[model samples]
Target: MSHPTADRARQLLDLHTQPEILVLPNVWDVVSAQVVAATPGVHALATASHSIASTFGYPDGERIPLDLHLDMVRRIVQAVSLPVSMDMESGYGHPGDTARRAIEIGVVGGNLEDGMRPLGEAVAAVQAVMDAGRAAGVDFVLNARTDAALRADPQAPRSSVIEEVITRGRAFLDAGAPVVFVPGLVARDEIQEVSDAFGPRKLTLISVPGASLPARELQALGVSRLSTGPFTQRVALTALQDAAAEIVAGGTLPAGTRPLN
Candidate 1:
């Protein structure tokens, strides 16, 4: 019989290739995971590191302990049947060790970014994740993220940043990264440029959160994945704030506001 875990990994991978764009509203905790899992046509679940950290009152950049993060991921994984991917910012520990823990909880994929570490070190970590996946017999998809174009260092020129992204993206893909994630490149033309550079490699776009470029625009640009990171959570928070203020002011609650018993 086929390995169930392997099948889950394959299922997650298959979603990335379907005709309709795979839209992942990255979730933070178990409730959010369950909510997304229960939604119609959600192919897979992903955790946004920023949102997860905030959910626990911790800052991003691995301020939360690796074990704590893993436990939360475990709960979310157990709460739903969809395959889940983690935003493992810089692995926190070695990527191989992190991958082992994540696999233990049935995660089939993860986003491993450089987190502004030395280029060589980041590349090595990516290799470690790939190796761990191989040893575990899980086709774990590692979405290798390069930050060159993420913040656009004031010191570096735009051309240089794009150049670095392509360079790192190429090296990572060559080293076995399944997806090249460039989160901060939101412009339609830039998206196209990056896609053109990567060719067959999958580009995970965290660009234009909540309809910046629209789904069709991204699909036309050859984006394999669109991660609506933490932004979705932020939108919910905004709505809640509005509803609370309305009630405090003795006004009618918003249409979707619910009271907690």
Candidate 2:
């Protein structure tokens, strides 16, 4: 039972030369994972906690049980040939045990957010988890996420944002994170500043909206990875809602609207 896909994912992390950003599209289920894998140059696939939780009729705040989350990861790995990365929200347990379990289940890498935890403690937790995975003979890419922008009010000062990201990122890197992800970033200057601060020592993953800069532009800014988060899931859900509303209002189904297979 050699897991070539899992091994390939670990190798992909080593294949980075420059920043050479890999834009990982987040998938909610097996079908979405398969479809994204069929696309050109998609090195790896990531799962969105928001998408997974919503699909199960639960909100995104860890309402879904650990058993359910592991099941989702197992099914996605079985469904796709590409390397799979999971959104293991807070690693699901104590750092060491959770990382060991995730590696055993075949998630090549994961995104762990430092949500409200002090920077030092979050870094230690991430390090412990990463060490556990490495000790299990699996190379794990712990993409530490700093949710400062997402958690803070829109009017929060720029100084606050910079300080928070820097402080948290330093801690996560010290703990052995291969990359740091900053979500909700929009401006080119901000992206550049963050990347510059991190430099070649670590990868900086950015989540950009479709309405924002194009993919080439993001890569030009030295983003090591770009993700869309749950945007695709949101789009799909919105379209379904629109069609359902039409049907409920005695209107015919839209011409291009086909039932999901």
- Please name the candidate that would achieve the greatest lDDT relative to the true structure: 1
Put down candidate 1 lDDT per residue, 174-254, tens digits, no spaces: 888878899788877777888898874378887454547887678878888888888878877888898889889998777
What do the candidate models score in CA lDDT, each in turn? 0.84, 0.76
Off by over 4 Å in 2: 1-6, 15-19, 153-155, 201-211, 246-261
Poorest 10 consecutive residues of model 2 by lDDT? 201-210
The digit string of per-residue lDDT tens for model 2 on 1-261 reads 756645765765764434566777799888888888888988788888889988898888678887897788789888877777788878665767776777777777888877858777787878887887668777787788888766877788986887778777767777778888877666788777777776653545545555466767777877777777788788777887998999999997789854444
Q: Which residue window of length 10 is worst by lDDT in model 1? A: 252-261
How does residue 70 of candidate 1 score in lDDT?
90
